[model samples]
Target chain A: MEQSFDDDEGVRWMLAWKAGDEAAFDRLVERYSPQVYALLTRFLGPRDNREDLVQEVFLRLLRNRDRYEPSARFSTFLYRIVFNLAVNHTQRVIQRAEGSLHGRHGDEDGEQLAELADDRASAPFESLEQDDVVRAVRSAIASLPENQRMALILAKYEELPYAEIAGVLGSSEKAVKSLIHRARETLRERLAPFLKEELA
Target chain B: MNLECAAFRRELQHSLENHAERSGAPLRDLLWHRHLHGCLDCRELLSAEEALEALLSSLPNPKLPPGLAQRVLARLSRPAGAQAELDALLELDRPESARPGLAGRVLAHLAEERALARRNPQPVRDLDVLLELARPVEIPVGLAERVKNRTRASTGTRGVLLRWRWMAAAALLALLLGVYAYYPRNPQPSPMVAMQDQPDPALLENLLLLEEWELLQGGDLEVLLSTLPAEDEYLLDLGAEGATEQGGQPKKG
Candidate 1:
């Protein structure tokens, strides 16, 4: 179950922002933008327009500010906004990326797929021995099935519990656990070489 | 494979549920220390888990553009800046009717409307309601007729269907209650608000919740979740950059 946020810092600040304290909203922007930036970077890949996307997230918050009553956690509401934005944005971007590629390489469909793969490419895994465990792990995570990848990232990095991850991902807790389990399994297999030896 | 291994895995389950494990918790659990002695794969799993945690902590953060918060706040304050940016964002077929000038444009229009309203105040002729005089009130899109027909036609399966409709209404009401519990300030909004009630975005979100809850009443949600595309293979082409630093990575939400 999700925790209550009736008195959460973000909620209080947002309520104050609703009460005409523009500085309160600024406090929220300062405090939460890093996390938002990180998630957008993760979800959208490293693109030039990322800061714009981050701005869009807050812009969405600003636009929908009145809709936000103090009922739910401000972070949860913000996350829902970002997650939906990212999904829709990713869908649009990838479609555009593919369309541009298809247009450019009208003849060579095979090469188009390969170049698209590298739109947000991982470093070559050919030299895993030289690559640090972190690089190996990032590539492995980048390669995961979408559901598993999101569940793991939210669970492991963002410090959200399985239930909240489920809430964010529109899945039940069991499904979230299944997703994480599948993610861990894949990570274990992919990073097996790096994971084999115990840490010093 | 053995009982101790199963037990070791049981103790390990809480690792994901808690954050302390990610911050690099020491191997203090005697059960963890004890079980690893007998199992090879379990020991490997333990090593992998620890290594993953370490790598995660050491992962680089994406470099932020100079003054990101400032940029966003500037846009918030400056309607002109926001208008140009929002026009670009409008390219994405976002569900909201965020047309080109959504932010600055809306504000400008509202300001204009305010000015207009002040300039032209319509004379108010208060209707005599206490006279109980019937005015030609337009029926609200046949809702009263539909309710009248439904009440008149409630019989057998029709009554059951009506009951199901009420149940769905109650379910929707409960979902609303869950998202927006007692509105403390204005528990009941004005009739104007009630007239303009639109579907809650949160209500749409919790539909998934209510669906899962209903399905799981006698079945597993995992089974249902299994059907949700684990990966849109076409979309996974976008790749995830959540973990990577600037410049290169796959993008997927």
Candidate 2:
């Protein structure tokens, strides 16, 4: 079950946690870990560092728990921490001295069709086509710039309102909207064949 | 595409996200309908966005690692009780009502005290009775004069003595008022008291608490400084005069 707390209830739990209610802390951890894990996986891709980064995110959450103000939704605060940690981790991985070993993954557009075919091994032709469409969409999303990718992820997957997404991004709502719009335009361009076929 | 169609396409996603029912005024809705009928690109864009949204919404939730929370809790080296105590103090370190339900409780306590005083014949004056007696109200024309006469008859004191006593009480009160109004109070407010604002009391409180807690202590500062974006790192370097050259660029020694 996808459990989520509204901002007020979340703040109450946060207050209780701050007041040393271990159960409240457990509730928060249980409630958000899956979502944070999913976000880290999607943003960082499947990497060895992803789990470590997720742990760092929670650790920072605990370390910086005092810095949280109930002014905005707790989710926004949590996501901002996630975004900063993910960005930092990405930068560090990029600059790692042994970076040559951890070469870039997910850059092969040529192999995308093959991957989709493999994913749909036993499926019918229609399912294969649908799977291809899904892969095409995911591929387009995975290829967006970091800021645009995150904005799209928060907007599309988390369904965060633009205002809250703006909070998470530390950008204005207009900027976030533009980011998503440009992201969608890029996705449309990348997936144009699948989109045209699907629409037809 | 015409400018109108372009404008419609640009706003189509926003509108669809907000107004799924296509709710608008008649003329506006007509324009939207006309635009959709005429502009194939807009229709396709809308369809594609919706299809992608559907696909994204259907993506399966990832399975979390088993025993994740226990793993996290185990990473916390500090004892839970100590952390809990500190957290409790932090929680209590907030602004609260000045006199939350205090008046009633004080009154009840005072009543109990008065009952005890009555049983023991103690000299403790009940403030409630004093307040009732001192409360302002209309009185007979010569009420003060009657009081003075009664006091003089009972204690055989002159009006001059009563006047001097009244003058002394007034002077004492004025002196006390002057002292209270002019004396230098504590110049510094507590950190928590220093950071009170309307909406987010916790924001400033947490900022000060973080500073006081020494979040950047030990090598954590280095880790944090390393995480600063390039621009911030540059500014930090420039401000600290740690940069060997001007404009945050390095100079070879």
Candidate 3:
């Protein structure tokens, strides 16, 4: 990935927005909306709830404009906010889906099993094989412990350096490396069948 | 290949994570190279890891919905008052004096305190009265008149009177110094001094009353009475006299 470097411009706009310039805020929103949208989409999966969440991320930026610390890169601060909100939205969606079923089914374990089965059965891919591969990968990513999942997203999707991801996640670079290492190992195991199919 | 499988796995994981580290390309450890050549399972793991990375990297970027920036800006087009409040909230790092409506906020806060004080009037009103009393006194009209009259009457003798006043002050100061010089530094109490130092019967009776009320325990009463200094005893005596002067009225009901 080509690592983009418009930080100086982005930071200039943020500082200007902090001083109550509306155009600066507009510029910032325009510049970062795509990244924010992409993060929310991946974090929340293919759900329609992401659009609102992306808007909320920007709204939060405006609402908290004055509190921005220029010493820190704006992207790190923005990702922290986006990650928090994304985690919250993801948890809410999971809870709502589970809550509705828990009332109907009355057996929590069975419902959880059913949910897992449904996740595999309902993957949106072109063919059965592709669906299995894609589903396995997505489910593996989703099932990761929140920190590992976020570490992978920030490193792989955002193309952030380990040090920068560490800053975003409030962890050491070594810790982030271990997180991504463990996460990738898990993904490799889950997708091994598909990899072998490709080899065959 | 003499590489332990576990060590090879660890190195492979490390290399994969650090492959594109800002410094340069990943390290190619000899053990990992030998293990991959010798072990089919390890080779399969590497291939799978590479495929997973490719799949992840190739995932489509989520397109921004049409008009998101416009929608966000539209939401931000709040009324001017709300915009100012938002600006104030965002600029909390700015100095309080630099924030808009600060004077208005301070005046509002003071007005709230004034209203609250009015509602709970007794303590605040008492404090206000105490402050008024403590303020410096202006010259009294009668005293002013008296001083002028006396000055006119004693004009010829004024210098002599002033000299006499200084002499009186000097004599009082000398007496005070003589008494201070004669005073014992750490006087041991004589029988007469002990008798004078003893608390009044009325005070002893009050301590006994407090004990009956269970307000003062026996040990506490002894500690309290034993630890009181002569100055505290004098003040207690004066306080008792003042209370008696008021016919021993209850200070609180």
Query: What TM-score does chain A reach in every model?
Result: 0.79, 0.75, 0.80
For A1-200, candidate 3 gives per-residue lDDT tens digits of 54444567877788776665668877888888888888876665665545656666765665455556665577887888788776655554465466666665545335544544433333333333566555556666676777788889887877787887888788899999989989887766665666566656
Error of 3 at A189 (Å): 2.0
Instruction: Please list the residue runs of candidate 1 whose C-alpha ends up more than 4 Å from where it truly belongs after superposition.
Output: A1-4, A105-124, A127-133, A197-200, B21-23, B79-105, B108-253
- CAPRI-wise, candidate 3 is incorrect
Candidate 2 positional error at B29, Å: 12
Local distance difference test scores for all models: 0.62, 0.60, 0.64
lDDT of 2 at B151: 81
**Which stretches of candidate 2 lie above 4 Å from their native place?**
A1-7, A47-49, A97-135, B1-11, B16-35, B54-58, B77-253
Name the better of 1 and 3 by lDDT: 3
Error of 3 at B233 (Å): 72
Model 3 lDDT at residue B134: 37
Winner on TM-score between 2 and 3 is 3
Per-residue lDDT tens digits for candidate 2, residues A134-193, read 545555666677788899888767778888889999999999989988987776666666
Q: Order of candidates by TM-score, top first?
A: 1, 3, 2
| Two-way DockQ contest, 1 vs 2, winner | 1
